[model samples]
Target: MAKSKKKQQTGPDIRAFFDSMDALASEKGLGKDEIMEIFRGSLITSYQRKYGPDARIEVTLDSETPAIGVSVHKQIVEEVEDPSLEITVAEAKKHREDAAAGEELVIEEEPFAFSRIGATNVRHIFFQRLKEQEREIIYNEFSHKEGELITGQFLRWRDREVVYVDLGRAEGVLPRREQIPRERFHPGDRIKAVIKSVELRREKSRDPGPYILLSRAAPEFVRRLFEQEIPEIYDGVVEIMDIVRDAGFRSKLLVRSNRSDVDPVGACVGIKGVRIQSIVRELGNERIDIVNYSPEPAELIANAISPARVAEVRADSGTKEALVLVPDDQLRLAQGPDNKNVKLAARLTGFRLIVKSLTQFGEEMSSPEARAQLEQLFSPKTEEGAGEDGDYTPLTELPGLSGRLISLLEQSGVKSVEDLVELEPEELEALEGIGKTTATQILKILEDVVSFEEV
Candidate 1:
């Protein structure tokens, strides 16, 4: 049997480019017209770079075909001072019957037809622009997905054991530290992760491109998983108040339901515990506690220490401090081994919590000094010299702060007055250009300036 002859491909190869452009536009959600406009500019740029930018040029696309045409508009003069940009009235009349001196003459031409270097420049411009447009399309697509759950294909592992997942349009990196230890990914496996951030990452001598940093270990990842699993959470019926997790180990999820009849915890738990069980399996059997959220901090703290009986809780809203009392035998359970239970509760509640047995609470209350110390703890810790809202003050707005001090503060990552408040005198002295005397001066100026404002 004779082999079928392959038909020879012919016509302006530029048509193939337009076809490819459409395909990429469809896939990347890019505008075809915008890309073609960029390509036209690039062609003109390549022509200018090669042919001394003396001639004014206009580029137009043929309506009937994919071919691009270039026209050099030259001044029709009596004498051609520069052949590239000026044409004699006699030469202009060859294209136009009534061409006259001082009139503009249009010379229809193709770019890079005469020089090899010009052709090479055009080729380079095409590829460079193509790469840039691709980067922009990817960045625009993924930037909107920051802090969102995305499904991706597992590609391969790279430096530091980070897994690169193909997120359809862009690649996302799941750093080893941000990956769940209990989970493993294989090539072609469908994996789900949360996009922690989208940022431009540059390597040596390479164009910076936006990359997605993904995570499965973040607390938000578990929250997103619950959002995916439970319809009530996805809709407006239920809301997640807070979530805290120790990836691949345990997680605490607090939820509230809008409807009085619906239990937020039960909605997440599902019938026969199927909903939470599915999420637990996805997390490699990580234990999840679905709890009802209470606006009251004491009640919330009490709920957080569930499975362990709490006798009472005293919470001060101002100081964000809390003291929990449990029965003597239940104290160990409330605190758990290594104080893991109380620590998780504190993180979830955003409260400084102290877990004590009922007996210890009574004994502490029995002493006058101890009682006085507890009262002090209940009051807000006052900043000695800083403004109550110094955190809102920019470094440049601080009184008595010199340009040199501002530069140093910027270098040390202290951009505002609040950052300075976080540092001790010793820590301030540890800065590159700061001495003990300078540290003391900075503190004194801060105190005096903020105090004067108050007065």
Candidate 2:
């Protein structure tokens, strides 16, 4: 009767272990069924190692009480060649008279108390199995999140080469190459990055942890950030048309509004620059230009050179080239420091932009001798129209001549058709916006318009 009473108490202790597991599952946001599955496998391994491979083990959680049950399997045989695999037939008959040879039987025994070494081994196996299962859960949870932005706390450096981030359920890695150059990370700092990839290593020798790769240097990172901060973008009212980046230095994004009422640039910039500022802060304060996308090449080129006021945009659609004219005083601003503005604008628009000052245009337009040569080439057939106005007024009437170019000709002192005929194509190409092809085109046009009589 005392043994019976002691066995009753052991059941309660076993039940308590299951209760603890349930509480842990609830606290950690893990499923109870998953925890139980892992617990079962751990117990089987531990029991087999401690006792024998054929040791009977049945694991169950008490619903009314918090406890677990582990039953060992014992078999009866005529002779015991393997003690772990069989028991004496006579002894088995004492417990079960119906037991026979080759008949395996399960024996319910009181929960065995583990020794110090056994207990430690059980714990190590349990936790190791639990961690592996948890890693699998985390990988499954986050594998679908590629190309999405996730926020995490900065953890520690690995191999002094990779930055580790503490995601809620798993650790994520931001390799040195994936990080923006010159960016620093410290423990406990909150950061955001895009999930680049997730690798699962299931080898028996490996730790079984997921290889999570993250990135902050990708252009898609910027796009995803805007999608988060800008409501219009998330709702699909605005679309990012193109992205041109210089990595850490700067990026230009071209966005267009899907709805007529929506202002794409204004939406991305947000009120008081709040939306883009959030992104800028994350990217180590990289400069960003949010330009409104335009279907017209001329308008798009003008927008691409933002902060540089453009007087006019003359585009050669055939050659995909544009000449942007700015005021004389704005030339420095148009070109930016070391011509950064023009360089970025060219990348953004995918066009060769020649930024010229208004002064340069005036010089190309106002040459008097150049005008006389043009007038003689297209001479007035009627005497009635001939007058002291040199029979030709504004040079802009020519197909390729803009008002700015006419002003440029006059400024250079080429006052008549004779002087224009003498000018060389190489001299014309030296102008800021005029390339070799444009210079050749202009020379051909001038030659066709100027007559020898006018010269």
Candidate 3:
């Protein structure tokens, strides 16, 4: 039987192609050293694909210039049998006179002609490898930057749903779901977008930088804009407690001052609304209402529903609910065109807000039929001591309630947790040593505490 021979796959030597060092460095923001390393690794991979997998190869790339060289490493032998892997001592000595039988010899040469179809394939393979490298670099950069702000040029539109941005070293996508529906970003316009996500793409995405996802609609974007536009917020004198947006048309920002003298809302709005105006322009003239954040839930919610003064706000701690009273004329503004304002205010304040006109609030307060309706609308099974629950725990059992708070509760004749739940926020604040902070904390504690028996 004849000995079977192994077939070898060879490709065109694309090393002859010159890739401008400046072009590569500019594309990835990589220095010459990094580019050379990438080139060497790419050559080794290309060489292995062209030659057999077991073929021994050594590749070198010029660190200071765009030059690459590859060599096949073969052992010097007294009598060569496999010419591809072994060189006769006499033949090795022709190049390196010190060559010995056991020593290795490196022959500098191109494995295939540059004009061969294999060369084109090798070039394509090399560039594809570079693309993967670039993907890794950009992915690493954006992954740590998710939710961070990035400014780039609007590249183009795609499918009428996505916008592409040219971030110097990588491309980013503004998916339709992340775009502001009311804001139009034109080609070549400069944009500042928030990094929504960064991941290694498995399937081909519609735009470049398939691994990058940017967002203009994220609430974080509005927060970032506020941070960028407001000097006091950036300086930490004013803090943004929370922000909620209707995405395109409007946004609500809750800001509070750390110092007693600095007005958070005033600082955010700047003198005559200059700072917020800059942010509003960036958001395509989106209406932004900067409201003061208070430790008091009712006050915060009342403020969140700006342009509509609240006659009174009644909050239920255990239910995490609030009743918002507005003048009949302001009811439309409080609830917006379709309850949009109240809905956003609820989100910003973390409450289930019930908005109503003052007349309606009064009717419920004074009318018997209205009282029954209110009872039906807001009624829930109350705990036993108050007459509706089978199980109950004392207010002292509230978690994280300091001894001082418990002492105050006990002194106030609050024997059971149910009794504490019935006190309004102002009543809680009025207790000795229970300031606004302690009152807020107490309300939160009660909101989540279930009776020991129920637990």
Candidate 4:
């Protein structure tokens, strides 16, 4: 009767255990269902480690109270060998009169009250399991945010290598490779980064939680800035056709207007360049070129080399080559220092451009040898005529050539008919604005004019 009364007190202790868990769940903002699961898992793990692998135990939390109960289940066999899994048939019959061999029986028992060391071990296991579940939750939450821009506060710098940022809910790492050169980060600095990736680690380890990779060097950073600064771009009225960036130095954006009345460049530049200036300030004074997109290569190239006047744009129909002519005074501006402007324009327009000064074009056009060659090829039997300069004759005045075709030939260095006759089809095609097909047509026209001279 004393043993029976002692057993009656065990239920109250189980109820108190669960009541503590409920309070913890409320304070930590953890869900009751998740906490209950973790508690059950910890109980099973602790029991197995102490009693061996075959130990059969069930752990449950009381629905209305903060109580936990652990029941050891055993098979009622004819004889008891393992105290953890099997019980004697006589012992089982004491609890259930109809119990028989191979029948399963459950014995309700209080967990052996743990010693100080054992209690610490149990608490450690419970917290470890909870931490593992929390990491998994964090991993799933941030994984979906990859490639998005996030705002965080600088926490600290480690080994002068990695920068740690506190992202409100989680910590993120900014590796040296992802940070821009010369950019400084200090403790408590407000920083922005693009979520490069999220990497999961082994569940039960504490070396570092699931890694959140952050970057300030990605090209998308500029695109995201434009989207934020330009209402038209954010609302989809302006589309970014292409972007070419030199990381922190300069970036070029080709934008197109969706509506006929909306100017994409004007929208991005804003009034007095306020919109673009805001973005520039954020990027450490990086230069931004917001050029209008054009389907025509000539127009596109012209816009790409902005603030540099284009005297002429000659494109080869077959080879898709373009020669951009700028006045001699504007050559320096067109090509920029060390050809950076031209290089950026090429990348922005998707065209391989040969930039030539107008003076150079004029030199090739007005050469005396070129005029004499033209006269011999067009009219070998006719008298030589003089015009402005030593022997400059309008190429259109030559028989069998239209003014437009003459202008095309002049732009291509074929100053006279003699120059045209000296060129092979391949050589002619190599000139700006000329293709194999056009070369063939021009050669045919020159040959007919020559045959007429013989007659």
Best by the TM-score measure:
1
Deviation from native of the Cα of residue 135 in model 4, angstroms: 1.8
Better of 3 and 4 by lDDT: 4
Better of 1 and 2 by TM-score: 1
Model 2 ranges off by over 4 Å: 1-12, 47-57, 63-67, 72-98, 109-118, 157-161, 185-188, 201-208, 270-275, 296-302, 305-455
lDDT of 2 by residue, 95-164 (tens): 5677777677665444356678877877888788777777777889889998899999999987877898
For lDDT, the strongest prediction is 1
Regarding TM-score, does 2 or 3 come out ahead? 3
Q: Please say which candidate is ahead in lDDT: 1 or 2.
A: 1
Q: What is the TM-score of each candidate against the true structure?
A: 0.70, 0.60, 0.68, 0.68
lDDT of 4 by residue, 1-455 (tens): 00111233245666666677789787656798888889788878887776567889887666665445676678878877887788788887776677778878876555546677767877898999887777777888899999888899999988898999998768999988788667888877898888998988775554367889998877778888888878999999999988887656677899999999999989999889987898888788878888888878888888888768999886553334467889889988887654667777877876666677888666755989755653443342324553322333445656767777788888877786545654656778887777787778787876666432101
Give one digit per residue, the lDDT tens place, for model 3 in 198-307: 88874365344446889988889998887787778888999887788887767998878999999887888877877777788788787889888777888888898997
Weakest lDDT window of 10 consecutive positions for candidate 2? 1-10
Clash pairs, model 1 backbone: none
Query: Local error of candidate 4 at 275, Å?
Result: 1.5
The C-alpha lDDT values of all candidates are 0.77, 0.74, 0.74, 0.75
